[model samples]
Target: GPAATWDAVDAYFGPLVGEDDVLAAATTRARAAGLPEIQVSPAQGRLLQLLALTAGARRVLEVGTLGGYSTIWLARALPSDGALVTCEIDAAHAAVARESLAQAGLAGVVDIVLGPAADTLRRLVDEGVEPFDLVFVDADKPSNPVYLDLAVRLSRPGTLIVVDNTVRGGAVADAASTDPNVLGVREMVDRVVADPRLDATAVQTVGSKGYDGFVLARVR
Candidate 1:
């Protein structure tokens, strides 16, 4: 989605609630540096925070850092001892994300693993990390199903697994769409829907992020 469209959506959604200027500046810097689109909308950020709190999430795993906008939101929901582990493939973007998270006073709560997310996740699992209270996956489109499998493995019963960009510009809705990214998303949705271990639902949303969507699932 275009930046202008995101701005327009932000405008329509009313003023951002907390540290929005910091988020916007970080997003601008990230884009100027040719980073992939990674910032979460204020509405979605708030929603993530709410979900964390509602789920009583203490140890969280985030598949993408992306200037740390969503990381800040998730970390803020944790208690004083809680922690968030976020993965980012790009060092430059990760550096910017560290700065943004520090600005939000949440740097201490987040640990950024700089590498391919799948490798990093496997390492964490191999190291015997405890089950995560929540898992947020927003990495490469083609890896959605793979990430979903990893997330489920890392979660305990009732853990929340949230996936961003499930709609893929409305491509996932059309069975005939041949776009690789869209097909990947549809396959992921179908997999999630059929998995007996998870109860899932996809919600369509429109805002500063344009007409995107997300899938929310609970490990059963």
Candidate 2:
């Protein structure tokens, strides 16, 4: 029943946001290439686009670039002069995403980096890269805390940090859990709680992707 409701909500709003042929083709390509279907749903993608637009984001950092689904959304929200850098560890995924981004006419706008995300973020920090207006972390679930720290390092005051899948079907509430993914999300939450430089909150969500939510933080 819950899933049906989420499906209904997605169906209800799907037409309002419309659809992108490039995005659809990208998903199709990823499926053909055996990439996992773990992308943010259309509604979630549009929400990301809207958030970037609302924030007037000019530069964006994405920790995951799976098929560049979400990357397309964020890139489209930016001005032509804007830039988006995304990281993916899997060479196949990065190649697929590179093609997808290029197909979306975003080849010049998005830089798809191939490597471990933690290392890439650290290098960016070491190079004194310009602060990003928004950072989206959606890669390895177990590295969320590390990614969050890196996001902070690449951000400035008022920067928005969005970490996906923080509420893994409610497993984050299990204080006794040993599952590293859940624990990773928990650790990130704890870090946010203890840190005074961020104002953040979590919103539970249900969609085609099922039950999960993201952590949204504003650097202070």
The best candidate in terms of lDDT: 2
State the lDDT of candidate 1 residue by residue for 98-202, as single tens digits. 887888788888999999999998888788899999999987888888888888889899999999998866878899988877877888888898899999888
Write one digit per residue (lDDT tens) for candidate 2, span 92-181: 999999999889999999999999999999999999999999999999988999999999999999999999998889999999999999
Query: RMSD of candidate 2 to the true fold?
Result: 0.8
lDDT (C-alpha) at residue 39 in model 1: 72
Where is the poorest 10-residue window by lDDT in model 1?
14-23
Task: Give the distance in Å from residue 185's predicted Cα in candidate 2 to where it truly belongs.
Answer: 0.4
What is the C-alpha local distance difference test score of each model? Answer: 0.86, 0.94
Minimum summed lDDT over a 10-residue window in model 2 is located at: 15-24
Per-residue error for 150 in candidate 2, Å, reads: 0.9
- Deviation in Å, model 2, residue 218 alpha carbon: 0.3
